[model samples]
Target chain A: MKQIEIGHGSGGRLTRDLIKNIFLKYINSEELDPLEDAAILNLRHQRTAFTTDSYVIRPLFFPGGDIGKLSVCGTVNDLVVSGAVPRYVSLGFIIEEGFSLESLEQIAKSIGEAAKDAGIRIVTGDTKVVEKNKCDGMYINTSGIGEVMRAMPLSNISDGDAIIITGTVGDHGTSIALAREEFSIEAGVQSDCAALHDLLTPLFETDGIKWMRDPTRGGLATVLVELSESLGYGVHLYEDRVPVREDVRFISDMLGYDPLYLANEGKAIVITSGESANKVLEILKRHPLGNNAALIGKVSSKCKGVRLKTRIGGERLLDMLEEDMLPRIC
Target chain B: MIKTQDIINHIRSLVPGDRKVRIMNVCGSHEHTIAFSGMRSLMPEHIELIPGPGCPVCVCPESDIIHAITLSRRADVILVTYGDMLRVPSKDGSIRAQGRNYKMITSPSEAIRIATANPEKKIVFFSIGFETTTAPTAAILETGVPDNLYILSSHRLTPTIMEVLVKDAEIGIDGFIAPGHVSAIVGSNAWNVFSEIYGIPTVVAGFAADNLMLGIAEILGQLKNGKIRTGNVYAGVVRPEGNIQAQNIMAKFFEVADVNWRGIGYIPESGLELRDEYSARDARKVFGLKEIKEEKIPGCICGKVILGKAYPTDCKLFKRACTPKSPAGPCMVSMEGSCNIWYKTN
Candidate 1:
């Protein structure tokens, strides 16, 4: 209790406590992003969205991208899914003592390159240094500000609304976990860490979009559970429809982890009117990041929590994840 | 697809409508498959699939946890266990929440690695699981262990608890979906007692959608035809005689002992302990820890829940006092536990 355990940063129960007891107590949740990814603020006559996220992954550089690129992509993706056109993003860094200057430059270059790819600018940034062992080799935080192109409120979501996800699931979590080489499991899975602005932009044009979320910390089930719980609706997801890579699924099975519960850095959950699902999916598949997109489930008035209709046609509650073993792996 | 539907229809036809038929699955993995696959919804309304004490973590006695915790409190001991045992709460606290030097592992083999890496510190593998896991732990022992490596075996026999369940009249389990993994060790012949002696039906099924349905269907087939026999639908893995080598390895290092079950009181010869030859590597003997006093969690129905006599929702503390995040007893603590599986899945 003296110092925080690894679970406090797990983005599950311990993370909730840190937020509810510390962050939410001092800062109202309303001021933050209702989705908890980024904040939505009305500036002048137009609605603007803002979001901030920190990247503290081990190794700092992974297969798909480095922490710097991830920091930028994560913040911008939050803004994008909130139906915002990401415009400007700020960067912040906390480096440990005796860290390599060359590595710092490499991370900085990765950050700049990622921002360029997402068509966002580095408007402002901050830097700090801590003693060795006090911090990891490096930690990064990125905040993005964007203009709301349209509104896709959870309030508009109703029974019969369909839930759609972009591309395969569990790549980011699986990639990072495998990179650790803990269980002697080897897989050629790459992290699906990229900006979603291009993939989600087309859907923003459609008025059928009820609400959108990026399933990051707790995967698709968490976002669905949170949205359903908030809106007092039940979700029925088809297990077969959820697209997860075979290798990822294999590793997940070997480790007793659910791919639905694993983190996905490059996936989006789109809730739209039932009739518009095919149209939205068609638009999404036309993009690079969303080629494997699918209409996975629908909002139901059946029950309060989420349920998964497994491949065998049996139904079970897909409850929100509890405390998993590791956290920063995300 | 046609085969599954035919099985489903046959199962539905065999199920008598007047009274409820409660068929219990005593394997944690089986319960997970049933819930995750939505197998329950496919069954007829009168057919109820109850989870038994198949989950090893759910039935691990609190005294073992107390013993592990006391050892974890030591400065030189590093207690290693599978993740399921971490969150179970006892009188003082759980091994994860309260222990000073405890680490979560995927298997017992990691204990060897931990022991090798830290030669100066003593490594005590707090082993807890059913036969599927126990066989592996025993195999690791046959290969030999490091000097500092010790095992705090909390493994329990699944058949013994199933016997306990049948003895309790409160839980009228009509049949059993015998744990396939356990059957792989003990064989389909091991569960013949339930069918031959107790006059109940037992089916050894794998942890798959089709396999489980076929198992349930086979049980219903027996009940409808008034037949009592031990069937093996998971023939690919389980035989009439189980994996003799793994069973032999288990017998080499351990023996059955009367042990206390969490919530459920002492069940005679229900647990496995290290034999006298392996006493040097037994942490319980090395630690000299004595008199493990068991404490009851007030208002907890975990004992009856694992016995299949009550549902998780029937517990007063369920969702209120006990949850997967903060479990008060072993039932709500393990993912395989009847309560945790029901609490999360249902």
Candidate 2:
């Protein structure tokens, strides 16, 4: 009945009508006043790392988890990668005016459950309405602030360090890509978007651990390039060591996408010394998140840039990600 | 396994310089491999791998997309394609960008079924992908489609694209890192054309960083020693002739036809079309678009990029206005489009 779909985004009557009729009834948060651009939160932290990201993933619901779970886990992973124990997160929802209230409720409940699992509070939030045609079914923007844990020297990444990946690559991005029904392949795939801090907590305390990073947006390639740019060191990654699912590898061959450049929400790369590398990996393997963790390669002071060792005893230079393989795939 | 560091040292010895030698890979899988290995930081200063138009999703032309849009809006049609084609742009708009009605699916088999289900609606599967995808499209056609079901076959053969690049004097490509899946389907015979015509060394590569690096090493070796031939670095999957069954299926349902590449004009006998037995399901024939002209997007250098004559960064709209979200050309849409690959990876 509502022809004015985007009108709900204007902070006018439709916004208020939708919130009062739908959100307020489902969520009993006293701090989430639907009108404000920013919400005031009283927290007990002096230092905070604040990050915001928009989730516009298609097919909101997937095999393992939906966009709701991903929204919370993605933010938690971000904070954890930055060496911050996540404290609290704020979610903003922009819903198409005519979308089902049931879907919204289900998403909200998921957000609540995910927050609980990560031990973070959704202290405050906002909701806006957009016309059905103007927006996808729903768009979520989540911002979180976390307190810096014991100062882990992520900026101290140097040459001759070891590179460790905590599990396989390409699951999250490939899963989303496949779920979009964009390619023709039959594979058992699921999103790897779980909170990674629990696994990372031990690594932060390890000796010679100079830097830590999560392979997200541009996947492991972006992380590798970013490290090289910052530390001014060449990296050597073992091709056979990088663990990837058989199905993902098969599909990657079919579609011509490299599993490495594919995104992983629940994976990270740690740069540390050769001595501590095995120890850190052993400790990591003990954790649930780091079960598939392996020493994929080493930090090389000899090579001045990134390069890959071929399975057939050949060598080619590896480069930074020049573009997105699966755009908006995350 | 040749350890990653040993290869790095060898490459350092090969391309010794004050600053790293930047080697741009023109394939999407290479981009992914480079990224996953974090190989950029792991290599010597004399080697830098840049991304080229390897991701097909990044470089698909807009004219084809416009054609898809036109077909998607038909009341008698339900368009189907791989996921990447949905958001790609055309002269008018994208099939999904325009909010046009069309179904996006992973399989050509699914498109065949949908077409059969909607017997009244003239279903057109927006066919795309390399040899891996062509097999499915061919399989569906060889099996058969309803009279109303048609396919606007925009599928291109990989070797033709490679031939176009290798022969291009302006491309400046010293060697080629041949596609793995395409090589698996079409075999190394297709690449033999490159060695025969242009004498450029071609390496059949795997998706792993090590495999790709080996392919690159072979290419660099060829470049250093002045050799020209096809090397199957990816012996794990690729063979000299490729998958015979897939080739048979393709040959059974379709024939080589001179189809238009969005930016690169028409390469003679480079595209696939349904044979006479399956021509009734050809969307172009059913829709009376036998005369569909390849309309070039104004001021777009996608054609030049596809030919490897121009780098994506050379285009004025490479980053500024023409992005994946608001693509001005087809090269900015398809995953394998050069511009899209550069924009996403670089």
Candidate 3:
């Protein structure tokens, strides 16, 4: 096959050949064939959930992990938190010309490793390259598919589901900020980039999980707002219970940023029945990734929006994050 | 290992009387910790905690940012700073909102790296912060072979502000919660002048809930004993003499000067200016911005908030008109601002 170039995305035989020869060869599963504008998959019995996300993090490599690992972990965490068992992921890559082959290989390997860790498969993918400067090294887009098992009963999510955040927020964003060539600090912060499905398996085995979500682009604030709008319920988070790393806290303080609004690559926020909350926390605490996990708040019937129960027993509204603080830092 | 409850009990014991007292914490990190950890909840009803102007970002005037932005417009100068200052807006525009004329940096050492990498372009780091950040800036100066780089130092000293606050402020504060990190550099003795002259007690407290309450306890203890003194609850990181090495470095490259704070107005000798020996790296020397005037957002109450003359909520723009997403004032824009803290955690 002819070596593909940026021209392939311009609509020609190069695009067809690249898709058929590369994408199909690797993701030759029956369900992922791109017959139309989209891949149509049949769902026989289980409830289905779908999500799409794009990763445009810079530097791409840091103390603990890289963007490839982040792309997969982020999307999988999303599916798992939404009360679904992640089954498959479709990957897309936009590469800059002159990018190193070795780096590409490493990234692909990390993606594979992350998929295995999450117990999901990369069933389909596409790749295209643009001239140097046309792309900032690389960008990845992922769409996830998950199955809501028939045997598992999903909570309709009533007024009193407890809100639990697995691990600290803002670690990944802070690590990325520290790794930036421009910024430097004494604190050693690493990206909290990992798969949370292993931690979620036990919780999924429980009977009270109502709604769950991984706080990604906008962190926990966005997640709470979504739940509040959807369930028509209120959330009261205790500022004290939220787990924030000292390094993360310091950097945010120094930069005038809030950890609550920062992004997290390897974390999940689960909302379950208040009665099952303790049991779910017990399951999570036994897992390494969730040792610092906290039951930061609970769903309330009165407030009707996201509110913070101050350490002083006062109330404050948690607003949507405004203009991105430290954009592209994640 | 110090639990928040332990601190609460200590505070309760210290404030056993029926009289009301107020304490102000000056560090931005302290503000962040107090808000995030919910430390204010543990306080007795009579003891009210107040925020200070010590947040380095909150205190930096908008004119300085305008000056830095103007210098950054120079094709040869690469503007550097910690990420927090990147988005801060000036009268003309924010360095970020204006575009890529400036670079957001993490540390002073990275500015050195950028200078090293470019070799040709002049790099000017817009150094802003208090004692915690001043040390790194001092480190860059000590390295000494300065040829292609400069620092526009807006670094302020905490003690100077404290002196101004204790003498003139009508805040009725019974004591002071001196900045813990700053105390580690300038030493506990630095605040002795304020304590001796004003007869108001001071305590250097750590950021943790227990540490803060302990500092408050010690200050109250001093009040009960009728002895005004400087106490250190953060002795682990702070000391009576402070970090001598950092002090020496700061004294070498910069000299104390009068500078205008964004909200608090001008306090004599409160800010650090680049000494003549390092004048070549100074942006004011590179670009004549000496004529620039201090301008503030009209009707903004950041000044009153910083001076403890008014609470953040007392400002007309405070949640109703100004917010973190759309800040109408400098204090509302910064994480250390009392308004920001109030908004983040009530």
Candidate 4:
């Protein structure tokens, strides 16, 4: 008998193998097969995107947001980035038998409020309780549906395109990490969790927008690596120009983490044409969610891996994550 | 303000284009800076930064790993070590890939907690690293340990191995960007002999991009004047006299012994073994696992790679037979190992 390892849940190479061998073979449709974070389906002369995400973050709550807010934003963002206007989301919960009723009510209240904040409805949901030994304290899953408003494609993404992010990176990761108290250091950090439908909607209507992705697991470097390999073009990031929270930077140095590899919930990594990058940045800066947006780097015709020009004066490749730097970061 | 561009300009003004300088840095973070900062883009085309065996996991011999893996398989033993050593490849398989009940720790002091939590099991703390890391482990040992705890000492001395590098002229080391952390513990004045005896200029610098370039600039200045001297440009943290208390603690608990480096083979008096008073807590002696043998991967040149004599890509197994996920050697395992750093960055 073989036991499962933590690597199986990393959402990197090991996770890829697990999904490809076990799940995709049986349940994957053409739209669902590629695993592009969400599936876009055409029905009755209407285009819509459907996505589902599970939130099982340990401690159930952290500095900024809890599992409730994460559940809504995580699913809604999946549909929002997939070229859709988020319409409705359904929630499901699995609780241990001994879980507190007060915690459950608080989670439910937060989820309801989050749905209102996103301007979406929690149209449906289900709940279940399992034995204490068989489960964590709480786990929430959300499935979302969004009506397609405009077409956003990645086929136009090529060399010379610029890569940009919404705000300071690694806040979500650093927040959860500090909450773990693994390093015995104190930092007043919080997760950047939010619904992006308002901020990203205007950008959805803009030109030069080739691709969009929320760097959830594996962080920005992994996203760049995936894009580079899939498109066969190199992704070069200006290391100094990459944004990170000052506190997160200090904590990362103390904890030996490369913030580039930390998770981000409220930020989006976007690719746009070089011709319209500045115009796009201006628009992104105007939005509240993207006030700190900056053009980090551009696509290149160099090595087929993610490259970083350091703040000091060295250049190197950024490899696809081989192992989980922070497990269950999302 | 120590501007990197001004330092680069100074370096450029000093070195003739015809004289290709092969500078070796014996620290992982330095290699990281060279790659992460694209610092090479600033250097003249003639200057090349070669990575040395400063990374402890890169030079950890395979025999110790085999022993650790064996212990990991035992029902009564819990092998505790740093995260970097988890995936290191041995003849059979890596500790992460094959072993069971292996726990990862960030520092030597954390072993006490793990040992306390697992009171019934034998907690074998796999203490493997250089002097800077060893000093902390030694200090903790002096504080005392749990009765069920043992230590597998695989510590190596940095200066002794740097001496080994100088003796091997084929390494093409023009001068050294000395490891600052180790120097901070071993003292900056300790590296003078490389300049005094081998005529190779050495500069101790911190692990910052500006610090590295400035150190290289100073070395270039020395080369231009044909001056053989050991210099310190990272005086902010590193002093002529290092942390003497740390040095004394390290010396108190460990004795110098001839030991084998993974790829570079045996180097005399370059290893640190637990002293006789601490033999009761020594895992190697207690387990009677005295005759561990080194096994080589057929075509892997991690040996040459560790010595700064060859690049990782120069090896046949770099991306094909070996990778970060499926590593075939120690160099590909550690986050700071030259192979791992080069693969991820370059």
Model 3 lDDT per residue over A1-330, tens place = 223357655547866765565445434445557434455666564688788888888888887888788888888877777667888888889988666655765777788778877888777677778887898988999999888642223346677778899899999778877788757576688888887778886776687876667787778887787778766768888887899998799898776567898888788887788998898888888899988888999888877788777664445677666566667754
In candidate 4, which residue ranges exceed 4 Å CA deviation? Answer: A1-45, A301-303, B71-79, B92-103, B112-123, B143-149
Which structure among the candidates has the greatest DockQ? 1
Q: Each prediction's TM-score against the native? A: 0.88, 0.62, 0.79, 0.88
Chain A vs. true chain A, TM-score per candidate? Answer: 0.85, 0.89, 0.84, 0.85
- Whole-model lDDT per candidate: 0.83, 0.73, 0.78, 0.83
Sort order, lDDT high to low: 1, 4, 3, 2
Please state the Cα-based DockQ of model 2 relative to the true two-chain complex.
0.10
Q: Per-residue lDDT of A125-150 in model 1, one digit per residue for the tens?
A: 54565665899888888888898988
DockQ-derived CAPRI band for the predicted complex in model 3: acceptable
Error of 2 at B248 (Å): 4.8
List model 3 lDDT by residue over B1-346, tens digit each: 7665665676687784778888888877687777666566657788888887866877787888887777778888788887657666567777767645677787888888888888888888889988878888998889863488878889988888877777765877778888887888889889887578888899888886567777888888898888998888888998899999999998888899999888677789988998988777787786666746667677788877787778887888877778887777777666666777777665
Residue by residue across A1-330, what tens digits does model 4's lDDT show?
Answer: 222334444557755764565434332335555566544554543887889998988768888888988999999898888878887777677767666655655666677677778877665554555665678877889998888876677677887999999888888888889888575777799999899988888888898898899998878888888888888878889888888878899988878688898988898987889988999889889988898999998998766678787776556778876776788776
* B1-346 per-residue lDDT for model 2 (tens digits): 5876666666555553444333445566666566544556556555545554455553344556677788777676688888878877665667887735699787877887787678777777878766677898888767766776678777777776666666555555566778787788988777887666776777888887777777777766665667778888888898998999999998888889887666666678877887877667777676776445566666778767666567678898887778866788777765566566566534
Ranking by TM-score: 1, 4, 3, 2
Per-candidate iRMSD:
1.4, 8.1, 4.0, 2.0
DockQ of every candidate structure: 0.56, 0.10, 0.26, 0.52
Off by over 4 Å in 1: A1-46, A324-326, B1-3, B75-78, B101-109, B112-123, B146-150, B277-282, B285-287
Residues A1-330, model 2: lDDT tens digits: 233356766777876876676555544443564445555677677778788888887888865677788888888888877778887788888787677767776777788778877877776677777765778788888888888764556556666678999999999888888888756666789888888768987666678776777898788866886777666777887778888999888888777778888988889887778788889989999998889999988777787666666544445555655577787755
Enumerate residue pairs that collide in model 3.
A81-A212, A182-B105, A183-B105, A183-B106, A184-B106, A184-B107, A255-B84, B150-B281
Ranking by DockQ: 1, 4, 3, 2
